[model samples]
Target: MSDLTFENVTVRYGTRRRGLTAVDGADLTVPAGTVVGLVGESGSGKSTLARAAVGLTPVTGGRILLGGDPVHRIGGGGNPRPLQMVFQDPYSSLDPRMTIGDSIAEAVPRRVVRGSVARRAEVTRLLELVHLPTDGADRYPAELSGGQRQRVALARALAGRPEVVIADEITSALDVSIQGTVLNLVQDLRRQIGLSMLFISHNLAVVRYVSDIIAVMYLGRIVEYGSVDEVLGDPQHPYTRELLAAAPRPGGALLAVPDDDPALLAVADTEPADPHHPPPGCRFHPRCPVGPLVHPDRQVCLTSEPSATPHRHRAACHFAATTDSATLP
Candidate 1:
């Protein structure tokens, strides 16, 4: 079993003038054999954090540990087999020129399957493991369907025998029907292989179906973290409430109307008031619907930054300390 832990991980890109903090002091733990969902809107840094976990992106600060051994220590090297990633674009991730068999074979260590015949057999077995036809190995990536390409990507990731697989929006590109099939395959793989997964997606419904625990990220930080039932069924943070409200429900009713006002949307996208540059308090005050009720001292909320604290589950908003009910409407 492999346990993945992120201790105050922070990832920043570019220089100060053009720099952005994609992930901000985030902390999460994925115990072996459980699926943990990282859910958020675009630009929320879910994918950024996923890349960092697999050594694809540099971690600007903090540590990523796998089974008590650090993989992304500031000055240390990474462990290859413990953490692996499946990207969002299956088509682009796989080589267009390379045959699917060759791609999967490349992921296998040369020392383990030295001969061509041995590697081919291992590749054939991997294809079957991922539910692809063994003969599909002869086809190039361009010849496969979108779902098939994704399965090939999964096969490649599995070739290394990783304990932790970070799947970043792996189903987003496929059709709805195909998405369900792919998701089921992932769930089945987890049960059969005892794999720990960090599933990142913007789709709440899909996350609910695939995840045991969910962490909601906003503007590079996690606003709430808890079991899927606790967070999605009964969201605690104001942002989370709004997100649920905006999501489409089963009865064909929209959760909530998205803010269409150009000016407000622009303001929402603008860089938040800096913790150091702002007045005294919460960073979410500007766009927070419940800000007035939650923080009567509006000045403080408009000025100071809030820290993550335990509530019914865990939340980073000031109201988290006082509110007991999970607002689901």
Candidate 2:
């Protein structure tokens, strides 16, 4: 099984004396052959979590396991490198000097890179796997469009035959039309290969389209986690409701939340907690409309961090059971 599990993972940048904690005590898992979409704001640590999964970032506390083997600690060599990441900026990730074929070949394991003929054959196969023309392999990063570059990036990641793919907003840079095509390709690839994926994006609509499960992150924590329909259709956390309200709807370019809505206004005006020095207790409490403002029972949100209490789904909120997306102002 290619299950990816993060047990209370925390990622900090710089020295502990004066560093920023980007991710804090995050417990998540991407089960084998499933897509878990992690959605949040720009600084919500979604990308950081994805990076930690592939060993790109240091895990300051807890463990990151790939199929039950600890992959977090440096030089933990028991596990095969089963994780690969497809970055958001395809152009920046690719080498300007190297041809697409050579770039993909770089991901080929050392044993398989025995000869030029083998490398070329592998590159061709990967290009075909990502739905790219074999002739495209000879081109440079600058020579390709955003969509093509993204496809190339996916091809390179697939070269490793990764058990899990960390897709960090890979389609965000492309145009809307192109985004649909790339999303289709990704879903197709997942179904064809039965690959597990942690799809990270700020776009809830996009996440909803591709995810079997959805995890809603606010600041550095996952405030809500559940099946796509459970979390998106009937979000318990205030943040999740705000996100759904902000997402675009059919025939409506964007969900036009009434300007006078107190909940949406508070959400819009509030800045994400400072990563280096997050708020005490619940990080989202200060801006949470349903906390002290709407319910007296939720006053505890200002002084205590809520655990992931399971009800309809797992949500870290004291009054999650009483809260409803439809009732939010």
Candidate 3:
């Protein structure tokens, strides 16, 4: 496995003149054999970015590099591809008409699939790796429970022998009772196979449990990227603070959203600006807790975009350097 890098990637919908920019100049990485978690609210462009990496959605600009080469160069007909993705809805990801074994066999490497005996053995091995019963291969997707079907999905993905797997909310649709089982399997697979992954989820707790690094996305940009402790324990962005504080926990305080703070109020009380016409300067300024709209004016947020530092633990905010966790919301 090699490092996965996104350099100034952008995904746009509609025409060039009137388009919705789902991802805007986003830069990120998934180090070899490491899991990077991308967390953001709905419509924050997490999935769009994931799709771009796997060549599902066309990139409007910039590049998706696997190791040092362009990602698209290696994936084609009858090729041993290195990138794979597992979607959110297990019910819809699999084929109801195809038997589980056949579906899994389709993704098996060509050399192994050339023989019936080898194909069967490979299917059995993958099923067992994901903790599914070997007998499951003979059944259709309809015969399995949601959790069981998800395990099958994972097995199918593994059959391709991918180096990097993008899990897009893979556990969000499962029952809470079985969510842990899937999550545990993912961890075990990574530990056993040393897979590099880009794990996407809106659930903060889930992300923290499975990720080596955490990246926070807003609207169409990454506002903060850091280790779990740096982003969650000592957040350097106000939006990051609001996100951590808002997550439900017993006896924990919610963000102190003052009455006079329009930016913060706008996030809770109104719809965000349309993606086709995002607010200039800072796309997040309309809802920023410490933008120029607040008491002490930081007018730059309304006039120019803030750039992220080229460091491991950095944030894209003018006040990021001075944002003290001691006064957290």
Candidate 4:
């Protein structure tokens, strides 16, 4: 087992000056045998960070280390791929024409197995690891249920015996009832294999369910990070607090529409910061409700970009120290 380490990693698209900075100096680590959840709103760059780890997306600056080796150098070619991705949409990830057995076998490194009998045996074992029936190997992805396809995808990712697994919203496309089944399967696989994982999603609740640590991203930067309880339960960043408040809970009354709530409207009216031309100072300050209402904090937020500092928890906010946990939703 190996840890996945990112040191001041930055990923951009096109030229540096004119391009979009999807991830900005992200420093993260997925320790061996543990899961790290990355939560953020749409276009927050959580997905980009995950892709950057596996070399799917290019890294514009800094580096990623897996087990003390440079990931970018080795990620492009390896017998057993160091990192494997389980994408959001299982249907799109798998080939409709290929049998599930073939798909899983295609990932099996030549070093791991040879001959038709060995390959077939390996496919059966992979399916069994994901809790899929042995017969499932004979069927195409289209014939399987959503949950089944996801499990097949997982089995395929594991076929290479990857050191790190990047699960990008793997459950978002499934039915509510089926999501639990897939999540449970992931949990089981994690314990059995002790594989380091990066679980990226916009659903805080889902992230909390699986992650040991959580990182909250806002406008391409990590705004808060800590243990799942510390970050999600007592969020320091205003954006994190807002996200938790917006999430609907069971039996809770419907939230007022954006038109009815000034705060919600403010959030809705403000467009996400452009990656190509990010807002000055705190990227979140323009839409932040606290910065405007608070006195001295407002000045700091408008003039300086707070560095992500660790003090029990890491938060990039000028007033994070003054934030009252009791007042947060």
Candidate 5:
């Protein structure tokens, strides 16, 4: 079992420019062999958090531990192959001119594996593991369909024998038909390999299907998180409630709404009030529907940052102390 933990992790960009805190002090645990869904709308820092997990982006603050060992510290002569990332765009991730086999082989260190024939055999095995045709080893990425290319990308990530896979918006670009196949394949891989994953997406329906636990991000912070069934079936955060209301439902009818004031749209469009220089209290109060109900105390939500304390379910809102899931729309 491989466990991945992020403790108060923060990722910020820029020097002179107002450094955008892409990920706030977010904390999460992907228990050994469990898949955690990190869901949020565009620019909510879902992808940024995933990149930090894989060391693709430097973490400005906090720690990322794999099985209790620090990720950044593991490069000092330890095998850092336990964590890997499968990106959102399969086409751009792959080299257009390279054969699929060669691409997969590139993942391994040159000292550990060498020679073209040996590499070809390894690539073929990986393709089979990802349920792709061995003939695909000879084709370039463009020659395959979107699903096939994604399979190739998975094969490449798996080739390293990674225990945890961070898939960042991986299926968002595929056709609905192809998306299911890729999701199923990932589910199959997890069961077979005992792989723990951080599946990032803005699509709530897809996240619900793929994750065991769900973490909802807004702006740069995780506003709500819990077991998938608990959080989705009975979301408590005002932001979580709003997000679900906006999501399309199966019967073509909108879900119950907490508030319908169009004024909220204007707040949503503006830049997430800077996290570093966030408004004097609850970072979310500016757009919170219940802001007025808890106005004075809501000042804490705007001025002082809220901590993510565990509850039957957890939400960062100031009124979280008084709000009931049964009361949510």
Candidate 6:
């Protein structure tokens, strides 16, 4: 198992002088044999970081290291076996024209591709690993249910014999009844294969269920990162608190409001922060609950950006250290 580390990674688009920055110097890691859950609202750049890791997107700055070795582009002179991604929407990811066995065999490691028998055996093994029927491999993608297709996607990713897997909302497309099965299969793979993974999802409950550590992202930066318990039970950043309060509470209970109204969560009332015209200081300052909008004395948020480094809790708000999640509202 190798460590997947992002060293101050950044991704920008259009042009350097005036391009929009999608990921602003993200410092994160998926340790040797663990899952790191990346949770954030939409447009938070979570998928950008995942795409950059697998060479699907280019980075403007920083290095993506796999076990201390620099990662190269997947199709640009680099082997894709070591790092693989199971993208969202499994139906589109699979080839309708090819049989499932053929698709899975396509990703099997070169050493294991000696002959038809070997490839068929490997495909069957992966099919069983993902809790699918061995005979299903001979069928086409259109013949399978959404859940089964997703399982095939996972099997295809596993066919590569990857050291690290990037699960980009792998279960989001499945029915609620079937989400648990996929989530359980992922955990089982992690245990059975010791596969390190980066699990990205918008559902905090799902993140808490499958992650050892959780990283909360906002705008283009990581605002809070810590163990699942601390980050959820005792959140340190206002954005985290906002997300918790905004999430549906069990039994119709509501989380206590953070210092101000749900301005950030109230996406309709507030203008979405644009990556092209990022505000000075903190990119999320405009929607921050405890920013100058709530208290004029907190002008630092408008003039200075918070810094984040690896292996540290990155409560990227200026007032995070002094404030408590319960005391916010």
Could you say which candidate leads in TM-score? 3
Number of the candidate with higher TM-score, 2 or 5: 2
Candidate 3 residue lDDT tens string, 40-152: 98999999999998889999999999898999997557655778899999999999999999999999878536688888999999999999889868899999999998899
Please report how far candidate 6 places residue 79 from its true position, in Å. Answer: 6.1
TM-score of structure candidate 4 = 0.91
RMSD of candidate 6 to true structure, Å: 2.8
Candidate number that wins on TM-score, 1 or 3: 3
- Candidate 3 global CA lDDT score: 0.86
What lDDT score belongs to each candidate, Candidate 1 first? 0.80, 0.83, 0.86, 0.84, 0.79, 0.84
Which of the two, 1 or 4, has more TM-score?
4
Compute the lDDT of residue 75 as modeled in candidate 4. 39
lDDT by residue (tens digit), candidate 5, 1-329: 66899988989998737577888788888888889999877778888898888778999999999888897665323233777889988879899999998899988545545787887888888888889989867889899998899889998988776768899989988999999999999889877887789999888889988889999897778888899988888886777877787788878766654465443554455455555566655677776766643344445565577776667467887676554446333
The C-alpha local distance difference test score for the whole of candidate 4 amounts to 0.84
> Once superposed on the true structure, which residue ranges of model 6 sit more than 4 Å away at CA?
73-80, 258-269, 309-312, 327-329
Ranking by TM-score: 3, 6, 4, 2, 5, 1
Which candidate ranks first by lDDT, i.e. highest? 3
Please report, as a residue range, the 10-residue window in candidate 4 with the lowest summed lDDT: 253-262
Q: Which should have the higher lDDT, number 1 or number 2?
A: 2
lDDT of 4 by residue, 1-329 (tens): 88889888998888746678889888888889999999899898899998888878888888899888897566334378899999999889999999999999999888768788998999999889999899868899878899999999998999887898899999999999999998888789778888678999888778988889998888788899899989877888888887787887668833334456555656667766676788788988777756753344467777788988767589999878766557444
In candidate 3, where is summed lDDT lowest over 10 consecutive residues? Answer: 261-270
Cand. 5 Cα-lDDT: 0.79
Residue 129 shift from truth in candidate 4, angstroms:
1.1
Off by over 4 Å in 4: 75-78, 253-271
Each candidate structure's TM-score, on Cα atoms with residue i matched to residue i, is 0.87, 0.91, 0.94, 0.91, 0.88, 0.92
